[model samples]
Target: MENGVKKQDQLTPPPVPRVAVVLFVLKGKSVLLGRRRSSVGDSTFALPGGHLEFGESFEECAARELKEETGLDIGKREYLTVTNNVFVEAPKPSHYVTIFLRGVLVDPDQVPQNLEPEKCYGWDWYDWDDLPNPLFWPLEKMVRSGFSPFPTE
Candidate 1:
């Protein structure tokens, strides 16, 4: 207690960091990305992925989120890396453990569709070396860490 003010024990505990599975769906030297339309990373360039559901594996999340957001079916996805993302600049602060994966599409000719317009603007392939400005926290952190989703030739 300071002065005449007394602070009680806070009932709400800190939130645990959530696991978000993000994917790198590539075609040649380009990767798939979409502008987010929801809270947290709203309006920022993000990959087609979402939070990891309970009882779901990382691969399952990679497949589900991709199909749900972009209507693109992935054949198989392998783990690439993980990022510790804490959105301190967000309007509402959040912490997330971002899992990265490299996904191969089931059909190479199947173009991506915006299935969830409420969550994303649209899907487009962007050159990895020349991405758009204002990337999502996790992606931006990965870029700053000198990480490349692509395999070295």
Candidate 2:
């Protein structure tokens, strides 16, 4: 019944991909680091993290990934940093919106057992002052810049 004018449908926006990293702190000196299983790429060291799901919050994703990857449960989490970076890997344009969460370890003495052996080799705790250089790029920057996941009081 319209005068030859087609109704335009509203275009829905594309979904944005997100990721969260849990910086597990123990004894106020050391932080947890995991070695990404070599097959993923050349990256050896990276913070515990992964992509966010359709309806999960950043905190939930961080906690879940931390536990799945390192067998660690983060009791309390605080925001550290938010980074939006474009990572270029041929055939895939990865746009990463990453949230860094400072987490507290429930049991410091418990050793983390990797559930996904094919993706993660092992885990280690390193002092803040003596972190290894081979860590993932943005993570290296975050450490060198002295960015604490916890807020300073």
Q: Give the candidate number with the greatest TM-score.
A: 1
Worst 10 residues of 2 by lDDT: 5-14
RMSD (CA, Å), candidate 2 to true, equals 6.3
TM-scores of the candidates in the order shown? 0.88, 0.77
Tell me the whole-model lDDT of each prediction, alpha carbons only.
0.87, 0.71
**By TM-score, how accurate is candidate 2?**
0.77
Stretches off by above 4 angstroms in model 2 are: 1-17, 38-41, 89-91, 150-153
Looking at model 1, residue 70 earns an lDDT score of: 82
Indicate the worst ten consecutive residues by lDDT in candidate 1: 3-12
Model 1 root mean square deviation, Cα atoms: 2.6
RMSD of each: 2.6, 6.3
The per-prediction tally of clashing pairs is 0, 0
Q: Candidate 1 residues 32-62, lDDT tens each?
A: 9999887787888988888999999999999
lDDT of 2 by residue, 1-153 (tens): 246644442243444554645454554777778777653334558788888887988788888898888787777777767887665662444567778777777776778777888888777887877876688766767767777654467
Cα error, residue 23 of model 2, in Å, equals 3.5
lDDT of 1 at 21: 95
